[model samples]
Target: MHLHCYRWTGRGADRARESERRPPHPAFPASPLPPMRTCDWLLKPRTRIDASPATVAEAVAWLTRRYRSAAESFLHPDGEARIGLDLRLHLAEEHLAGGVDVQWGIWLRGGDFITAAVICCSPNRHAPHPCPAAS
Candidate 1:
């Protein structure tokens, strides 16, 4: 008989990539930089907002300015996103020519911290390291 061990890597390192994952609970880093690692360095825009926006619309606008394009099929005739927070807005998420899944989203933690990012989730399983699409 044999036992197999699973290395319990951080979900961010697992196949289902997301910006939602954060450091373990209760402890907060004193560093000014956003708590980012791995693919984030390879994916997001250079600007990161450390302060929260006054409203969801503010956040949406910030993300929109960074990414001017959207998946036409996912948006309205006005080029706005189908989903809404309190009212409505546009979100950018689309598949690249090579089948790369590109997604943009906002990360929020209370009224003090909020930021937006764009990540090109590897076409293959997992992140760039174990991903066949990486070269």
Candidate 2:
């Protein structure tokens, strides 16, 4: 199984800043800095809003709330954002024997609409292990 990250940067340049600064997520240790990489999606000049948990459903809500275009029409009513974890495929394999760790991010375009989604797997010291491309 493969994971895919998706973002919708509508009618503009990409606008995701790779921050060397960490925002205090428990998953990261105090000493180890977050790896730097281009965000899964970058929609420029669009408004961005911050949310808690940053779930897929939130992304869907964003798109539906702001845009009436065909692109924003497919948001699931459940608002479950797609979970494209590279490890989901190996869940029954060796990796599961020891358990695994994962990280995910959702960037919204126009503040309410999601423009990009990113999911990084283990050993992401360099960059996030990208999933399949989003439409």
Candidate 3:
């Protein structure tokens, strides 16, 4: 589970437990995440696999690999590609707090294909999650 640390990030429970020696994902939010009891959430993948790294640097690298392709897809040869922020963070091990829905993503613009993103949202106390639209 790509745990942000202690809690699940996208990695499964067993996986996180297996690597107890390693300090969780090492990127947990300082305060505390909103009370997100159930893992019953929705997932939107831009591509087949989702490799959301824990840090911004890693995410950059992940995007770097696709730069060439992105360049080719731009509507214009001189078109520039952009990287949109898609960070999902929660405070460390503490009682979850507010009900702010988090939908993180790594957007890409330009190239042969338009920019695409992967968004993941969890349910909160107020309303059902994976709820209405994750499109």
Q: Per-residue CA lDDT of candidate 3, range 1-135, in tens?
A: 121111222212222332232222232222122112222222212222345455434444444444444444344443242332222222211122233322322223321123222222344443343422333
Question: What is the C-alpha local distance difference test score of each model?
Answer: 0.30, 0.30, 0.29
Q: How well does candidate 2 score on lDDT at residue 127?
A: 44
lDDT of 2 by residue, 99-134 (tens): 222222233344333333333223223344332222
- Candidates, ranked, TM-score: 3, 1, 2
Candidate 1 lDDT tens digits, 1-135: 110000111222232222333333222122223334433323222232222334433444545543343222232424333344323233232222232322333322221222233333433222442221232
Tell me the TM-score of each prediction against the true structure. Answer: 0.23, 0.21, 0.31
True lDDT of residue 55, candidate 2: 40
lDDT of 3: 0.29
- For model 3, name the residue pairs that clash: 1-11, 1-12, 2-11, 32-91, 33-91, 73-111, 73-112, 74-111, 86-105
| Runs of candidate 3 exceeding 4 Å displacement | 1-42, 45-47, 81-112, 118-135
